[model samples]
Target: MSEAPALPPVRRVGQRSTLAYGFGAAAYGVKDFGFSTFLLLFYNQVLGLPAAQVGFAIMCALILDAFIDPLIGFLSDNTRSRWGRRHPWMYAAALPIAAGWLLLWNPPELSQDAMLVWVFATSVLVRTAISAYEVPSQALTPELSADYDERTRLTAYRYLFGWAGGMVTLFVTYTWLMAGPDGQPDQLNRANYAGFALFGAAAMLLAIFTSAIGTHGEIKRLPRPEIVTKPLGTHFRELWATIRNRAFLILMLAGLCYYSAQGISFALATYLYVHVWQFDTAAFGTLALSLFLGVSGAFVIAPRVANRVGKPVAAMVFMFSAAALLATPYALRLAGLFPAPGDRVMLPLLLTLFAFNTGCGVSATMLGASMMADVVEDSEAKTGRRSEGVFFSGAFFIQKCCSGLGIFAASLILHFAGFPKGAKPGTVGVEAIDRLTLYFILAYLALGWAAALIYRFFPFGRDEHAARVAALAKGEAG
Candidate 1:
């Protein structure tokens, strides 16, 4: 009874413009590391909260994030705005994140219980506001370009920028935030307030400006669809169908496992390096530098590797390689062979494993983003609607929810393993350290294998995506 809107032309997005959006996408990771990497340490070390209480606080905040993300996606999809659905929210999130980052870092004078409440409440508000922007920001990708190779390029660029942001945060946090003025490493130092707050604020502003400038003409204003104006129930039903799509479902599962391992591993890093390896706080920077380089190198090389071998094969190979390498630390430690506590053996181990796993991680990032785009096309084919918001919402759901689960798991595991907050030395036992190391190794192995299996079920690799694009050219949605 209603005419379907004419399909928008698949524009060729150039490297510069795409990279700009990628920078914006990556800037979000600044906030990510802010929360995941430093927040627990902040509460436990600076605020004097215990490990169990810190873990409990994080879980509560994550639960809030889990419930709010989908609702934000649903609202963002239906929003009618002249500045565009995503950008308006993107700009709005900047201030809240800045304020929240400041608040999380410098809590007002309050009891530990009151401090927990403040952190939990503000974290929920900050992350929720961020999702409001991020879900829609990602939704813009499919709308920006539909070419198969173009999507991969965009992902690569974004991954690089995101990795850059993460690395910057890591260096500053580990080096300056935790160091005393005498250039000595002091785990208790919090005077690096200027450095942390400045970067967070800078990233937030840079992202807003980049999104506004980079995507000015890239995103064409489409006539608002009557179908999109339907009731909330209609949107929920459509979102349900999108979730049920097999390719998306599998990817979501894989993301949950892979990021869970990643999250847990990151949370455990300060402890592992200090107590287990007996390295100073500065070693965290060295290890992070190696990890960042490894992952960065992988992102750079992934496009060519995916082009030569199939994306799935490349992804599978890298995933397994990462799993093997991640275990090297544990293997060496268990064998009573690690460098003495202060010898920086962890640096060499990190470098070796990171070299291989970095490439693997790069391949995974490329494959994962492209896979989601393909699924979006496939869903459009079946449903006869261009629902990029819903599509990316599902993608965001998988990625964030899984990473949140990972962080959640890490919090619980650390508490159970007796890993004390602030590395309150000798409070946690050697038994706990052994168990934690084993947990890290086994968890990464399972996550890597599970992600590979999910890729197997996803039929939208390079060739398939090309075919799908060709079909779209011939006036068929599939």
Candidate 2:
């Protein structure tokens, strides 16, 4: 092959480029947040699907996720093509993702059993398609610039756009789709399918356009590995080696625990609003807005805070604080201090605690993502090959698997707690409420703290990253 040309000067990802990337990445957040928040409700209530079936379908999807995520990442890493390593796959996968997503929301007009089959099949398709896009898309962040700080900036920007997309999702559901008839249960009538179906398609298209148009000039065209000589077993063994790395293992475990908690917390919010707070469906929108503001503010400041206190310490502080703040609601509910569900007075307190919890949580999240980038450098030092995609795929595999299980677990908990499909608050036994509230606290506090503490043993700190970067730069020059 001919020698590659000298690359163009690295462009600082200014506001325009950042917004563009954010818009591209927002598809990732919208897909998850919209589906997590509404999909369960849509299936159980709107479509009259049973809780057990939904749980089974989601579990199947997750099990499939464990395999597909890593395979897609590994394939992209070794792909031999001129269009470049990730974007070729990234661009090609867009249509399938959109189509599969839309299919998930609209099952065939058939019997309930047939509907379940349709749902399960579409769930797998959409999840796989999305994994293809996201695994490669995330790889772009580190590949775009090797500078650690620039990577941080790009992640921050991407997350902010994610928050913005989530806000759009929230507004559409609250302002229109999820509007209840009258003001009480039994009078409820809302179906979010229209908004979700349309938005899913539109978001995917915007994602492709933003990424294809914006950063084309910046990414280096990495030489693809020769695949014809290497067999399938070679790829799987290499993937195993990547997973066996101590740093990668630690990151994967941490991502699993962290995202599991996040997924459950989000899934439980509907019950919290309907049962614990007694607010109308629309009121949750206000609470979601608080999340948007709080998390966005934290993303803006997380890097500076991490720089000051060190990433590990900052992560520990924020995560612990969030767990504590989140627990306050359960405590208040026990103390008889909170107003009855749906009391206007309770919204302010709920908003405040949730905002604080989400803000602190997002700060830790930014640090964790940045820390993973450092782990990539450590891996290259050990193996002498840049395998960010492989490592990141393993990391994402854990994250998605945990998230899927978390949602599945939440369903089982709700079932045991007597949160019957479309069951109203009073209809559900008090014992069930007591059980679920306790479970929420434990998932957030206990599981979350364990995930954070695992990071304390991580060896790569800020100074180490600086040193590693310098060494790599020197090696390149030589």
Candidate 3:
């Protein structure tokens, strides 16, 4: 087996470069905002498809795209190009992502079955296109810096911008595009989605191009793997061996659980806001601001916390904290100890809890991703290969699959709650809303706790990662 050639030492990435790299995640954030926050509502309420069918179509798309992520990752890893391995794929994905984003929200009138097929196909296209960029783009994290704290900081930037992009778009959608003439939110108006879709497509295109171009200068500084003549089976064997690292597997399990909880929260956000909370346009905008502020707080909090405790411990702490806070509002409401849905105090209270919840949750996620970057060195030390693409893609693969399940679970929640189709805000029965809140609280807490506990099983810390990095450096020096 050929080891990867040593190319460059880890250096502190410059602010410009870090910002560029981080901004690229906005493209993905835009895609996520559409899929997680709006897709179900648009299809179910605006287009008149059933919630279960929308969820099924999206789940299928996500699962299919999950399989495609590894291929993109593998191809990007092995590709030899003057522009370097990752950027070409990132550049190639921009236009398709834009087109797919447009098509996904602009489906023409069709029978329910045909619409389902359209939803499935467009969703697959969008997800695959985004994966082409994201898998490779994220794979850049480990290559850019191998330092423990630096990776955490970089990951924080990525999450901050990702959340900012999504939240900004969301804020704009609720306050402007989706608002009625009377200044209330009118999300069920099909015409409102056209502007949202266009804005998202444009944002995605700009983000992809900006990041690919912005980071283009680092091509020569990144690692250059040795060209080896390996047969198809050998490559697959190596890929499998690399991903089978114990730490990587543990992180994947944690990600599966964490992202599942996130998916449920995101998929049901609009439902909870509109039906249960009766939030108006102003309230939605404020919620988006709160979420953005939370993630920004995470940008400051994650690395500091990870530096104090180990990444795994910090992640577990944040995960557990986030879960408890997330469940608090629902539990309070269910217990009849919370503000009424339309109470003046309800919005502020919810926003405050959500801000803290997002801060903790995003911190946990940042630490986990940084942990994955650390895994690259650990795997390279053990296997004589640096498989950043494979590792990150594997992480994303788990996230997409599990999050898909979460979305499906959300649909089930709605179905079982007997949430009526086309029901306006404030009209959903108290019983159904209560049922929805209970189911969400239960699932969210269960998954959150499971993920936090699973994080404890991660076998390495900063010291282990440092040792692996030094070992790899020594081997290369020899």
Instruction: lDDT winner between 1 and 3, please give it.
Output: 3
Each candidate structure's TM-score, on Cα atoms with residue i matched to residue i, is 0.90, 0.91, 0.97
Model 1, residue 140: distance off in Å is: 2.1
Estimate, for each residue in 1-478, the C-alpha lDDT of model 1 and write its tens digit: 2332344346677666777788886567787777666676667776678756776776677776666777776666566666555667777776776776666667678888898898788777767766777787777666666766667677777777777777777777768666656544565656665567677767766875786577765544432334436676876787787668877777777677677667776666666666666555566677667867776777777777777876667776767667777777677788887654546554676567766776676578567776676676777677765666666676666665555556667766777676665665545678989888877777778887787776666666766766666776686664
Tens digits of per-residue lDDT for model 3, 287-401: 9989998998999988987888889999999999999999999999988899987788998999999999999999998899999998888888788877888888888777667
lDDT of 2 by residue, 218-254 (tens): 4443333334466778767766766677866776676
Best by lDDT, which number? 3
Worst 10 residues of 3 by lDDT: 1-10
| Residue 374's lDDT in candidate 2 | 70
lDDT of 3 at 449: 94
- Cα misplacement distance, residue 8 of candidate 2 (Å): 12
Checking candidate 1 for backbone clashes, the offending pairs are 260-406, 278-341, 294-358
lDDT (Cα, 0-100) at 64 in candidate 2: 78
Query: For each predicted model, how many residue pairs clash, with residues at least 3 apart or on different chains?
Result: 3, 5, 0
